[model samples]
Target: MYRTILLPTDGNPPARAALDRAIELAQTYDATLRVVSVVNLGDAGILSPETVPVDGVRQSLRGRAEQIVGDAVERAREAGVRAESEVVVGVPHVEILDAAEDADLVVMGTHGRSGLKRALIGSVTERVVRRCDAPVLTVRAEE
Candidate 1:
């Protein structure tokens, strides 16, 4: 019943697992896949020095994000699924939530962290699950 499927990736193994699942669902439902990779500029801001030009760092992250989404879009197209992708600069969960607004469903991967570790590290998937309006299907990373 899904018309549009949202898939967010960071080029990680967990995200790769989710990409596979999202592609499968898109194929089954004849849905258009929307793949996105967000560059968390805040993290870079904290690590970068005043001497380092922000534009250089942003361009680097943007390039990487573009590659991640481009690869995902290529995979989906190779499987004969209609797909589009974008690279955004923002907080991961916030950007994902914004993208999810137009999606019929959101498919993503979770690290499955729990308790103290989870609390300390936080989770983008968890935040998206909590805030997104559309239905979210989470694929856990294999340990």
Candidate 2:
């Protein structure tokens, strides 16, 4: 039933697993896949660094996001799924939710971190699941 699927990747192992799942779903449904990677400027409340030239960091992050999305596109192509990619700079959860507005579904990876680790880092999937209007599929990373 999905026409356009949005897969957000962080280039992490968990995200790779999610990409695999998204590709499989896209292939089965003959859907167009939009792979997005959001480059977070900083953690929580802290800004990266004013002295370090924010533009340079943003450029670097975008480059990395491009590479990540490019790799996913290649994989999707091999699977015969139509794929497109975009890189955005912002909080991961916010960007993911925004991108989902035009998508039929949003697929994302959950690290499943809990306790102190989860409390300290927070989960993008959690936020996206709460905010997104489209159907969200969350794949948890294997231990």
Candidate 3:
């Protein structure tokens, strides 16, 4: 049984699909939903002088995160689910794992990218699944 469900979104198509599933599950179980969007801090150590400034990058990321989570929260509300949203700036996987402490379950979407692409970009869902103490439900993006 789930009382509080955490759904992390990035405004990606896959994430939207996962949000729908999370909402359906929340409704079925009479649970509250908490949507979170993490703004990743890009590589600070290796940035060249010609690269975009770190502060500018962070601001852009934060703005996008806010927009994504706000939209997801509105959708959840429209579905008659009690929903709250938060935007955090940090490592995605670490923030998600920390959030799981207060949540009964974490529902996330997987892009299903593999090999070098997956290794370079990494998989937040996989990291969350491996590290979070709470139950994680991963929904792969539909083809």
Candidate 4:
């Protein structure tokens, strides 16, 4: 029932399973895969002082994000699915929700943090789940 599936990866262990699932779903439905990684440039910026750690950290984070998306696209392509990827800089939940506007579904993973811990730290996946324009399928990561 999906035409384009948006998979947001953080290059984390939890995200690997979700990426695999997204690729499988795309293949099964003959749909396209769109992978994205957000750099979260809220505090880390390229314009920071040249010698400040933020500059290097931002560069490193962007490189990692690009690699994650590129790898995901390659994996999807190898699976015979039409796939594309993007690297965005913004709040993870915001970028993901915005991207979802053009997607049919969002497939992502959750770290399974709950209760006090979950309350203490809000979840991007949870935000996307609550505010996404399209349907979202959240897979729980293994402990």
Candidate 5:
């Protein structure tokens, strides 16, 4: 029943798991996979004035994000699934939610952190799950 599947990746194991799942689902449902990698600019906001060039840091993050999404798209294509990809610079959850507007389903990876650790380090997947309008399918990373 899916026409478009959204896959967000950061090149982490959990993201990789989500990629595999997304590819499979796309193949099954004859859907197109939209792979996206977000470059979080929040780190730049937290840095001191003495840090290295902010432009250089942003370029680096953008490069990494492009590589991540490009690789994910390649993997999906090699698996015989139609895929398109993009690199966005913004809050991870916000960008993902925005991209999800045109998607039939969203498949993402959850780090599966809980309790104190999860409280201290907020979860993007959790935030997206709470606010996303499309159906979300989360793949947990293997420990």
Candidate 6:
């Protein structure tokens, strides 16, 4: 009984796996797919003396996000599903949770990290899992 499905991707292997699963689910349920990629501009705390061009980095990241969402939308369309894409600027998990508010379900890929590695790097999928209200289907990457 899904009308809208949210697929959040980072263009990684695991995210690709989730994308495949999302396509299948959308096809089966005749649901509209909403593909999204979030460009995380870091918190406002860095006062770098090294003249790192902040604007250039943001632009590059935005371009990559656009390409990623665009490609996913194309694939979904080719699979005969109604699809739309969005490139958002914010924290990955936060943006995903916000986007999922209008969707019936969220399908995401898990990076499958654990222990210290997971703690140190942090897991966007895990954070989404913890805070998301919609039903989330997490697909793990092939190792």
Tens digits of per-residue lDDT for model 3, 1-143: 99999998898988998999999999999999999998875533225466657777677778888999999989989999999999997788998888889999999999988999999988989999988889999887779
lDDT of 1 by residue, 79-127 (tens): 9999999998888999999999999999999888999999999999999
Comparing 3 with 6 on lDDT, the higher-scoring candidate is: 6
In candidate 2, what are the lDDT values of residues 45-110, reduced to their tens digit?
A: 237555667677677777888999999999999999999999987888888888999999998988
Over the full model, what C-alpha lDDT does candidate 2 score relative to the true structure? 0.89
Of models 3 and 6, which has the larger TM-score? 6
Best by lDDT: 1
Predicted candidate 4 versus true structure: per-residue lDDT over 11-120, tens digit per residue? 78778889999999999999999999999976576567667788678888889899999998999999999999999888999999999999999999899899999999
Q: What does candidate 6's lDDT look like per residue over 7-124, in tens digits?
A: 9998998989999999999999999999999988673113434577777777888898899989999999999999999988887888999999999999999988899999999999
Ranking of all candidate structures by their lDDT, best first: 1, 5, 4, 6, 2, 3
Provide the lowest-lDDT 10-residue window in model 5.
Answer: 43-52
lDDT of each: 0.93, 0.89, 0.88, 0.90, 0.92, 0.90
> Each candidate's TM vs. the true structure?
0.95, 0.91, 0.90, 0.91, 0.95, 0.94
Q: What TM-score, to 2 decimals, does candidate 3 have?
A: 0.90
Model 4: CA > 4 A from native: 42-51
Indicate the residue-level lDDT of 81 in model 6: 95
Cα deviation of 84, candidate 4, in Å: 0.5
Question: Model 4 residue 45 lDDT?
Answer: 62
Candidate 3, residue 12: CA error in Å?
1.0
The reply for model 6, stretches above 4 Å from the true place, is 43-50
Model 1 stretches with alpha carbons more than 4 Å out: none
Off by over 4 Å in 2: 43-46
Clashes of 6: 0
Q: Which 10 consecutive positions of candidate 1 have the poorest summed lDDT?
A: 41-50
